[model samples]
Each structure stands twice: as structure tokens, then as C-alpha cells.
Target: MKNITYYLKATFSWFVLPFIVLVLASAAPVKNDVSEKEVIRLGFIPLTDCAPIIMAKELGLFEKYGVNVEVTKEASWANVRDKILTGELDGAHCLFSMPFSVYTGIGGKAGSEMKVAMILNNNGQAITLSKDFCGKVGFKQTGKVASVVAAKLKADKEVTFAMTFPGGTHDVWLRYWLAAANVSQKTAKIITIPPPQMVANMKVGNMDGYCVGEPWNGVAVKQGIGFTEISTQDIWKHHPEKALVVNKKFSETRREDLKNVMKAVLEACKWLDNRANRKRAAEIIGKLPYVNAPADVIEARLMGDYNLGCDQGIEIYRDNYMLFHRNGETNLPRKSHAIWFMAQYMRFDYLKEAPDYNAIADKLILQDLYKEVATSMKIKIPEDDMKPFVIDLDKAKFDPNAPADYLKQVNSINQ
Candidate 1:
């Protein structure tokens, strides 16, 4: 009886132990299918709008999302473009129109397809004139500014203006302001100066005025070297500005990694949009490796407290200030914005002929990818990606469907 009992116990133990092992093995969690990249190298220029990328690195948002990110401070937009194209950098805080220009073959040597993953920020840039023009031209008074330019031209004195990049937001703002005043940008010398250098160049009388992103604009005002003629917001409220961009190959090959990076940046953007966080955000990005500007300089404009430095006194425009993630409005990679940029390029003769606007925008903007990232974050995605918006200049409505007709009606100095 004892032997029979022992045999039965042994048999039960063998069957039960095997079944337990099999159940545990089957229940173990599956390894994540998403490929985790070891390191992501991102490039950025020393401008206030680079806050999203800088804050992401400083706040460990990238690591929080399982991405190891390294932020490189690039010297200029040209350098940023080159690094992205050559894979020296994985991605960059680039001008909104930059990827479009690159993809369309207008920005560099040859056309290399590029992608604008997301918009970094909007409406922080300003058009600043040297102190010499302080009493001569006033804010948003483009007609007076044009008259001054005309007078300078009549006297055989050269009037030079600067923008950060040829087809960049700064260039568009400066050109739009000039054109609105009947001052042909072609008639006035338009030069490209790095944003950080705009103040120094103005002090040395290299340029009469410049349009650039902060804190350089704020720095100029603080240094008493230049004054803000107008904020970019005045030209077009909440205009699309800097973007988070990458090469097409990178976007396609490392899609998961790109999505992770975008998720990190979106979090940073949300953090920055909170007015309570602006002071801290300014402090972080103002560090030596990032913007390298004074915290006060970066914080003021960042919080919508503008001195204008034109003796116009301080003005608080909280609602119309630079925005990062206004409930996802600022970050959406809208195709309409891209269409407007292409329209500008064509209007300025950057493109000899208008390529398929929707096609180019669809190829470059990656709205669907943005939607995927935003949705995963529980951020509300706008139902209509393309909406008709009006610029403050002429109140001319821009219909994404008929960009060509809008271009025809657009008051282009290039024409």
C-alpha cells in the first residue's frame, strides 16, 4: 500500500510541475516590438524658439519616453540643413519652410526629400530696426519705414535688411512687411544673417534692420542697439514658425524612434505653453549650451511681456504671444501651413513653377505621423487639418484648396 501511494504521488508531481512551468512560460510578457534606438542626435540653433528641443533634453523627457537624445547646437540654419542631410545629425529645430525648400530643391544644391515632423513654436520672431531708425520709423508704420528707405536710396545710401534665412519665416515676415509698405524687397538689399549675430551686425552698421527669432530680438532691445518695429504676430497672428524636421530616410527607417522623439517634444511643448512654466523654461534654455542669453531677456518675450525697446513702453500680449502647444493647435503639422509656404516660395519666384502643392506638402509634412503621436499622448487632434485662415496684413483669406489663386491676389513685391 505504501509503495502504490508513493508511485501515485510521484506521477502527480511530474504532471503538475510540467503544467505549471508551461503556464508560466506562456504568461510571461512579450518583448516590446518597437525598436529602441541607442542614441538620437538632434540639432538646434541658439534661438528662443528652440525651447521645445532644449527643454526636452534638459527635462529628461526624451529618456522618460525611452529615447536617449543628444542635442547639438548648430551655428546656422545652413549648418542645420547640411547636418540633417548628411546624417551628421538625426534631426533638427528647423525653419518651417526649410524642409519644404530642401524637398523642393530650392534651399540647397540638389533636392533631397525632407520631412517636417512637427512645428516647434509660432509668433516669437520680430522685425527690429537699428536705434538710428527709432525716431524715423515707428512700429507697424511700414509706409514711414518705406519712405525712409526711399530717402536713403535717393541719397545714394545703401539700405540693407537682414533675415536669418532666404526662405525662412524671418525672410517671409520681413519681405511681407516691406511689400505691404510698397517697398520691394528686391529694391532693398536683403541679406542673410544668423539670429544671434543680428544685434552685433546692427551695432556695427552692417544692416539697417533685421527680422529674427528671440532672444536676439530681446537682446537687441535690452542692449539699446535696436528696437522692435513689429512682432511677426502683427503680420500674421500665430504664423507657423520653426519645425522639428528630419531627413526622409531617417523618418522612414527609424519611424518608431522618430515617434518617440516627437512624443518627448510634444510634452515639452505642453509644459512650455503654460505661463507658469515660462520663467523656468527660460532659465533652462538660457543656459550656456543652449540659447546662452540672459534669463530675463529670454523670459520677458517668452511670457508675452514685450518691452519693444522703441520707447513704446511695455506691452503685455499674453494671448497673441509665442505658442508651443495651445491644446495642440501650435504643434499640429498642418498641410495648409505648408501650402502657404509653397505659395510664398512660388510668389517669390523661389520655385520657377508651382509644383503640386498638396503633393509636396503631403510628402513633407507627415500629418498622419503627427496625428499618431498626438493621439497616443491623448492630445486632441483637429478634425480639419487644412482650414482657411486670414493674414493680418490684407485680411486676405488663404484657401488651401486654391493656393494659386491666393498667390495671384497676394501682394507680392517679387512680382
Candidate 2:
């Protein structure tokens, strides 16, 4: 009797298991018509702008949109780009210029193609120097750039500066600052270090200065290793930084899923940008596996309370810091921004020759997708949002339509 009962139970369990799974699956909400079983794998650097991904996961936005999302922390921008190219990453919190570089076959890809879905953050990066140097330069409030560079140049010692990637915003900011001080990068040595390593490297004398994104800059100052020399936003207010990037293949094959992910991220950005929630967001981000730094260190910057760590002291409210949802600024993959990066690439000789500017901008930047996601969520989309915001870094007006010519003009200013 016992043997017969066991056999009957085994047979019944097999029949019921599929039915239960089918019923559970039927109850799941489907967005974008993609099945619940589909999973999205994304990559991000340990920077603050990646808050959207973490916030989206925390708020159940990914689940709401039928995306079983797996967020991975990539070591560097190069790793992020490689993973996207090989389809190892469905998407990434990548540098804004990365897709443009890939599309132009500039840095990593010889012929590989990629695209950016949206701009993630604007202006949460800083150029910081070792504290010893800060004291040596007799840091000044008015003559900030000249005083530091002049003191260092008089010493006739080589100053080693580090940046996050070859053509990234950190690098551009560093170079621009150096040029402003009449310090030729051709004479100075610049190295690529990961963002998280900037502070530690400075402490060990591996680098004299670095240009990196948030938390790390704060980390350096907090640890008493370095002082914030210049915030990148001060150089070019509301500068473009990271983005939602993926291979052109994934963007095409998983178009619906991709759109859904963007929608969820836009919602996350809205939540993160809320003024009342800034403190809570800082606390959340400072925990393990995220920034893992002090809450106060992360808090002040996110809320726009900045300290230079020099005797120059603090900036109470700087409006130029990262604004994920201010007037939906983060969503627009603006053409002018791409043109700026293209010019940077040309200025740095990252490109062997000039690229087809208009075609590359259109192919890489998908403002249409951003608009669709924003409109669906009832977020106000700006009509002239994509208009040009030129930087006088090289003392020239950048033309979005003729980016190559703009590049040449900017380059000529320096020469």
C-alpha cells in the first residue's frame, strides 16, 4: 500500500508542477510584450550616476516592466565597451563619448558599432590635487588656476595627472584645465586610472592630480590625501558625463525590452532627483557594493554642498551638479554634446582622421527613443532641448551640423 501511494504521488506532482508555473506566469504583468522569463544584464562603474540602476532595482521598476535585471560593476570603461561589443553586457552605465568613439571606429573598435540610449548624468566630476601640492601652491581663491600651475612650473618638476579613460569626460576636463593654465599636455604625463583608484593612487604618490567623478573626489578629500582643485561643472556648466549604452545588435534585437528599460531608468532618475529624497539617496548609495564611502561625503555633493578641501572652503549650492531629472535634462541625447566629444577626440588625436559627423551623431544618439519614453511617462520634453551649448575651452563656437570643421577650429585656437 505504501509503495503504491508513493508511485501515485510522484506521477501527480509532475502533472501539477507545470500547471502551477503556468498560472503564476499568467499572473505576472507584462510590459513591452516581452515574456517574464527574459532577463537584462547591465554593467556600471562604481560612480554615483549609476544611482538610477540601483534606484530602479530598489523601487521594483525593473520588475514592474517585466525585466529581470542583473546589474554588474565593471572595472573600467574599456571593459564596459568590450562587454557590450561581445554581447556579454546587454547595456551599461557608460561614458557619454564611448558610443561615438565606437561608432567612428576611433578607440576600441576597428569596425564594431554601438549606440547610446540616453544621457545618464551631467556634471558630478572634479579635478583634485594632492594636499601637499595644495599647500605648496599657496592655493588662492581668485588666481586658482594660475597660482597652482605657476608654483608647480617654477619648481621645474614633472606633474603626473590621471584621468579615467582616454577620451572620457574626466580626461577632457583635465586637459581643458591644463590648457587654461598654459600647461601643455604634450609636456605633462597623463595616465588612465580607474575612477575608484584615483584617491588611493594619489595617496601613494602614483599621481599628483586626477580628474574623476563623484564619491572618489569626496573620498580623496575625506581621507586627507587631496583637495578639490576645480569642479568640472565650473569649467563647462552642466557637462555631459555617463550614458545608457548598448551594442547596436542588442538595441535592434531587443528594441521593446530596451525601451522598457529606458522607461524604468527615467522613472528612477525622477525619484533620485527629488530634493527631499537626496539625503535618503545618499545613505542608500553609501552602503556596501555601491560607493561604500561615508554618507556625509556622498551627501554634501549630491545636494550641491561642495568643499574644495583647501583654505578656499565651501560652495553651499552649486546648481551645475548632476541633475538626473531637472527639466528632464538627463534624458536628451543632445547632438551638440556629441559634437563636443567628437571635437575632443579630434583635439586629442584619438581619431586618425575626421569622421562623418552628422551620420555618426544620428546613428549613435537616439533622441527619438528618449522622447517616446519621456512622453509615455508624461515627463515634459523640451522643444529646443537639443540646441548647441558651446564650450570656450579652446575659445571657439562649436557647430553641431559641421562638427569636423568645429573640431578644426577648436584645434587651431590652441596652435
Candidate 3:
């Protein structure tokens, strides 16, 4: 009788424990429904604009949003683009125009659709000329530089300039600056060099000048190899620069994951825009695994303390500095900004004909998604999508409504 009772109790215990375990499992909340932990990988190059993504990971903002993120340091913009295209990386700190170019099949393998979830930064890049061109061409004097290049071409030599990527902000800025001086980009050779390699390439006489983002430009000046001829802000004040881009497939299938990621990055950008945190931010991003430069080298530009380094004295530009979040202005993924970039694509003959500007802008720029994230964060959204504005140097107003006419007015447009 005792043996029979013990057997009965053991059998009853198994059934009761299984039922309780099932109930508890059903009651537990789901943490990340969109993606599994340790699955998402974000790529970034070693530049200042990559700060938000880095900060997001370092500050545990990604974790706060219940998303696991691994930030991968990329070597070049092309690598970043290719990784996104091949699905090796989930997203990256990319050029503002890169996704558009990929969408249009400008420089990628084919027309692989991509999306710009948000603009990463603006007004931090500059045109750095080699020390060799110091005395010959002054800042913003593209005409003199053109004349020098023309003479070089006349002597059966090549005048080469480098940008970070083709159809990128650096390329567009360099081309626009040259065109303003009546120099045809066709007359000179333009090469693509990665940002981190710009200073070293210039040092070896590989290129006459390069247009790239901060720390590299700052690195050039500090190494006495190059000088800043003009900043991108000087080209067009508060012009768009880098963006957070992702594969279109990822965006479509994993919308919630993307939203959470954007929220974390937006929070990071807000933290960076605070002037008081910049010094600490600089130190954090300048470590060997990140920008891999000295904190002071990165901080000077981050704080708007410019040392043009071509016998041009220092200039302080606190208002038009590299801004990540200016009361939510910097975070807006404006369609007008997309239209402007498309206009440049048309200008440079990247597109044989004018694209459906509005359609393309609407498709590639995730403005509505950006708004949702911004609103949830209590950040103000822009009242309108198309804001009419003029670039400071050009003085010609850009109307997103009439991109074709604006392209015609541009002296740089290739006929």
C-alpha cells in the first residue's frame, strides 16, 4: 500500500508542474517581437557624423528601446553601401544621397531600392586642398583653382580631386564649387577615395584636394598636409550630409524594429546637440574602436572652432556648426532635401532625364516614419514637408516643386 501511494504522488507531481510552467510562460511579456537579441548589425565609418549611432550603442539607448544593436566600424562609404545592398549589415551611417543613388542605380550593382530613415547630420564637411595649392588659390576662390587645373591639363597633365564617394555630398560639393568658377568637371579628373585615407593620399601627391567630413579634414590640418579652402556650410549653409539608411527589404519586413532603432538614435542625437555634452561626446567617439583620433582633433570641429590651416586664421562659427538636433530640425527627413539631391543627380547627368522628383523623394525618404518617431519622443515635427530655402552662397532659391527649372539654372549641369 505504501509503494502504491508513493507512485501515485510522483505521477501527480509531474502533471501539476507542467501545467504551472505553461501558465507562467503564457503570462510573460514579449520583449522584442520584431527581431531577436544580438541579430541587428549597424555599420558606420569613422567620422563625426557617425556619432549618433555610436552614442546610441554606448549609452545603452538601444537597450532602453528593447533592441539589441551591434555597431560595426566600416572602412569606406562604398563598403557601407555594398554591405547594405548584400544584407550583410542591417543599416549604416551613409551619405545623404547614397540611398537615392542606389535607388536610381547610379553607382551600385543595379537598382537596389534603399531607404533613408533619418538625416544623421549637416554642415560639418569641407574641401581640403593640399599644401601645394595654398598660395595659388585662396578660400572660396574656385576660379583660381580652375585656372591652375586648366594650366595643368594644357601641359598634358591631370588635375585630380578626390571625394568620398561618387554621387555623394562630397562629390556634389566639389563639383558645384568647381562649376561656380566656370570649370567643367569633364576637363579635370575626379577620383573616389575613402574619407580616412584622404589625408594620407594627399600627403603622397595622389590628389590635389579632397572633400570629406571632419576629423580627416582636421587630421590633415594638424598633420600640416592640407588646408580647408571652404566648408560645406559655406557651399550651402546647414546643408544635409550623412543619413541613417537601411535596406528596403529590412524596412518593409521589420518596421517595428526600425522604429525602435530610430527612436534610440534620435535620443542620441538630442544628447549630442547639447553643447555641454560635446566635450564628453568627443572623448567617447574618439576612442580607438570608433573615430580612432584624438579627442581634441574631433572636438575642435565639433565645437565650431575652425583652424582653416592655410595661413587662414581661425574662425568661430557657433551658429552654423555641425548640428545633429536643433530643436528637431536636424532630425527631419525632408522630401525637399531629397529633391535637391535629385536635382544634383540631374545636374551631373547621373540621370539621363529628370526623374519623377516627388515620387522618388516620397518613396526613398521615410519622412512619415521619422515623424512618428519624433512625435513619440515629444520632439516637434516640421509643419510642412517642402520648405523653400536658399543656399547662402548660391543665392538661388530651391523650389522642390520645380526641380527641373532649378537644374537648368545651375551652371554646373551637364548639357
Candidate 4:
């Protein structure tokens, strides 16, 4: 019996000892796949949609996909655009209007061709009026109140409105909303202010109103400096806001790197969209290295819960609340999006000459690259690259290829 017990103990020890050694070996430090590759520098403004870029770094999504990514916080959209254009960044979390503006050369010099790898998000922007204007207009959350404010503004002195940049999502949405309410962009003094500084500017009464991404709008409402007059979703539901922008040069030369970056971003977007992961995401983002806002502030819109604090706060739920990956829908570079932006540019007279509109769009929007990355990740791609979309301001129907035809239909003043 003693011999049998000794033999059993020896056998158990042999198996357990080998298994423990194997486990310890597996627990040894993982050599990051990213370390083998050239670092891909990504630029982003501190907007909520920048989640994907941030997540790619924080969650090791880029490393998982075998790419080294460094995210740099940009001060302004113009700086983000210039960096990507000049190769200061390999790519960026960029404005949706940027690719179109660069393609049409509306905001910058003519023929400044840039490419959009993917649409990062849609409709996380809102137009906030200073508290002074809210009190004057008696802006309320419910009823047909916005029109009343619009009428009052029309009758009274022109109010100064603010947008982050010309030909950016904020400018486009603000213009579209103002036009819908019969308020011309010209009627109000629309000036540029960096989004991060919007709330502070409002506090000082430097601007009467401003359109910007979260948590700035939330910041305004929280501070009682301003009220959210209209969410961009009111202008066009799920309207595209920002995209992954790259210079034409980068797109042409470093095709593989671009594709890899998009793939990692797509994964990050998926991770951000999962409802179960959102609170965790907000907490992660709240860390100083990222947006640095209170987790609740970022989490509010991120969870698609909004308080349009005006006369009082109203709860609004939108599925399009700054989506990164609604089954990867936002990641597609649809031609209709380009067409929509073109119509806005024409409405604002940014596109003086039509430069082979479709040709330029095709060159800049790499739908094919998006397709490859989406497929690799097993995400579905919608059949049509271009879909018919209408802007509410003038009931304008934007055709992807024939933007000039769409432009002709608009009776609004064009410069």
C-alpha cells in the first residue's frame, strides 16, 4: 500500500509540475506585434468619435492587427487637415466634410486632393445658443419653438454664430439648420472658434451661438452659458460627420498601411459600439490621456441619451448618436455623402468650378479599401456605394455624380 501511494504521488507531481511550467511559459511577456512595424501616427481632435482611434491604442486593437499606432491630439480641425495633407500624420480622425472640401478645393487651395478611408461617425453635433439668447428668445425644448426663435432673430439684430472651421461638419450643419429655419449664414456673423474653446468663448459672450461635437455642447448646457437649440440630427438624421482622412500621396504610396489602419479602427469602432462595453469605454476615455472629461459627460451621448437643456432638459434617443460601428455602416465611404457635402459647398459657393466631380470623389473616397478591410473583419458592406439622400433645408436631392445638376436646383444665393 505504501509503494502504491508513493507511485501515485510521483505520477501526479510529474503531470502537475510540467503543466505549471507550461502555464508560466505562456504567461511570459508577449512581444507586441506592433514593435516589428513602423509606427503609424494618427491625429485626432478631442471629440467623442475619436473613441475608435483612442480605443485602438488603449485596447491593443492596433497591436492585435500588427500595427504600431500613436495618437496625437490636435488643437484644431485645420491643423488636423494640414498634418494629414503634409504627411505630418499617417492618417487622422477627420471631418467628414474634409475629404469633400479637399477634393473640391473649397476650403483650401484648388486641386488639394485628399482621400477618406472611412466615415468615422454621424450626428454627434449640436447648435448651442448662448444663455443670453435663450433667455431673450424664450427657447423651449418642446413645440414649434425653434421657428419662433428664428422669426425673432430675423426681426431683431443679427446674432453672431460660431463654427469651428469653414467647410467642416459644424459649419455645414449650422448652415443647414439656420437655412431650414430661414436664417441665412450671412444674416448672422458666423466666425471660426476652436471647438474646445467654444464653451469658454460663450461664457465670455464672445459668440452668440456655436455648433460643435460633444462634450462641448454638453459643457455649455452644464455651465448655463448656452442651451442646445437644435441637435444636428434634427437637420439630417444620422448625417455623416467625420471620416478617416489621408492625403492623396499617402493613399497612393502606402496602400497597405492605410488598409491596416482602417482595419484596426474598424475593430475599435465595433468595440466602442457594443452596449455592454460603453461604460467601460467612457471610463477608459475619461482618463487624462484621452478626452479627460468626466465619464458621465462622455457617456451621456455615447449611450445615445441626450438632454437638450433649453427651457428645460428633454430626453432624446437617437440610434445615430455618434455611431462608429453600427454593424460597420459608418465606416463606408459612400459617394452620396460626397454629393451631399458638394451641395452644401455649392449652397455656400465654395465650389466655384466643378472639377470632374465624380472623378475626384472616386479618387479621394477609397470604398474599395473599405470593402477589403470590412470583409477581413466579416462586416457587411451595403450594396450601393452611393445612396440618395435629401437635405431638409431646401428639400435638395443630391446626386452622386451630377453635383452640378443638384447645384442648379438650389435657388439659394451662391457666391
Which digits, one per residue and each the tens of the lDDT, describe model 2 over residues 1-415?
9999998888778887778889999999755433456678999888888888878877888877777788888888889888999999999898888777766666576557768898778888888888876655522356456435523643566778899877777887888787677665676678999887888888899878888989998888788888888777777767778889887888888888898899888888888788788788888877887777788988889988887786668866557777887778667888777777887777766776777767678878888888888888888886654455556343456667667666555533223
Error of 3 at 76 (Å): 1.6
Cα lDDT tens digits, model 4, 172-218, are 88777666555555556888988788888888877788889888888
Q: Give the local distance difference test score of model 4.
A: 0.76
Clashing pairs in 4: 96-242
Per-residue CA lDDT of candidate 3, range 1-415, in tens? 9999998888778887788889999999855443466578899999988999999998888988988889999998889998998889999999998877767777685457678999888799998887877767765444233445423434556778999888888998888877665677787788999988888899998988888999998999999998888888887987889899998888888899899999999999999999999999999999999998879989999999988887877878888999998888787888898888888888887888777788888888888889888888999886756867887766778888888778777786334
Per-model TM-score versus the true fold: 0.88, 0.86, 0.88, 0.87
Count clashing residue pairs per candidate. Answer: 0, 0, 0, 1
Pick by TM-score: 2 or 4, better one: 4
Query: lDDT (CA) for every model shown?
Result: 0.84, 0.78, 0.84, 0.76
- How many clashes (backbone atoms < 3 Å, residues ≥3 apart in a chain or on different chains) does model 1 have? 0
Which residue ranges in model 4 land beyond 4 Å of their true spot?
1-30, 135-145, 148-158, 392-395, 411-415
